[model samples]
Target: MSKISKLFKGSSSSSSSSSRSKHRSRGGPTPQEAIHRLRETEEMLTKKQDYLEKKIEQEIMVAKKHGTKNKRAALQALKRKKRLEAQLTQIDGTLSTIEFQREALENSHTNTEVLNNLSFATKAMKKVHENMDLDKIDDMMQDITEQQDVAQEISEAISRPFGETFDEDELLAELAELEQEDLEESMKSMGGLPSVPSSKLPSAWHGHRTTTKKRVEEEDDMHMLASWAT
Candidate 1:
């Protein structure tokens, strides 16, 4: 009887330990409760997934509206625009410098042409003046040569004798008397000379006076010779 009581106590302790182990193995909940907890966890995870997807979609939409799909792409485009702007500014500066240099070159060319034309004109004028001076000098030399020839001819005529036996002084006086008579006749035929002498006359004529007496005497001598011969 003692041995059977000990065996029953041992079996009761073993059964209690087994029941506690079985309860602990089920995680202190029923199968239906576990299923409900799993469903709740699944629902929360689904809602979080949906919220994240919607937020991602909204971000994509915002990016599309702003014209870029990503931050890096947008930054690259901005940098490209800045570079293009800098290039355009540099090109404009180069063009401005070229235009200014072209204008200056044109002005310099124009000034050079003007200076060349002015120098040519000045040279031409100087040549013309020199030619005119040479022409005037030639005219003066010709006039002097003509006057010398006339003077030589007059001197030769004055030294020649009128007849074979006449002295030079008597021949010259007779030629002078005849020239005076002929000049008076010519003046009378041309309606006579002015009472006042010409300003251009030689100074030797200023004191001279003449008459037609020698002409009348020579004419009477010629008539007497003609009568005697008849």
Candidate 2:
């Protein structure tokens, strides 16, 4: 309304702003500090309450001591005790309110921290899932399944039996019959052969002829053993 008042108001506002900045620079009380302050106040109130209780007890003793002897003194002591009791009641209420405030502040601080952590975790999960596409994953899995089926079919084809089946007994019977025919043909061919006369041959030729006959006999024995093994 006046220049002086306006100047005073502006100065006052500047001072308040400076004070707030100073407080901020000093790092104003956190929830923990506030809770600590409340606890200290609560403790102080409890101590005061105890002092009042003790005072009330002393006044009661004084009232009892003076009750029969001095009525006036006894009335004064009773009045003091009543006043002390009132103070104690007031302290109790104050302590209750401080404790409630401290507890609420602590709960709010804890909830704030929990919400911040949850928010951080949610952002991290969002970033992680940003690279993923469910449709691409599904398509890749389907392709893998098809490839596995194709591989299974190829494996089956590779392991399949390739030829017609024949009985072991029938094969053995046929081999024995072929051996019998060979034996009969050999016996007939030997029977029609002319025997060598060693007396008319040269000594070296006879020796060679004897060795050839022995070798032929050994070959026949080996062939017979092979047929038996088969």
- Model number with the top lDDT: 2
Q: C-alpha displacement of 214 in model 2, angstroms?
A: 61
Ten residues in sequence with the least summed lDDT for candidate 2? 185-194
Q: Which stretches of model 1 miss by more than 4 angstroms?
A: 1-68, 134-230
Q: For every model in order, what is the number of clashing pairs?
A: 0, 0
Give a tens-digit lDDT track for model 2, residues 1-230: 95535654765686568657756887676777677767766776776676778889999999999987899999999999889888888888888889889999999999999999999999999999999999999999999999999999999999999999999999999999987777666656656334767467888988898899889877875765575457
* Residue 115 in candidate 2, Cα distance off native in Å: 1.0
lDDT of 1 by residue, 55-136 (tens): 4555455545556557775555555555545655554565566556556655666787899999999999998887567778
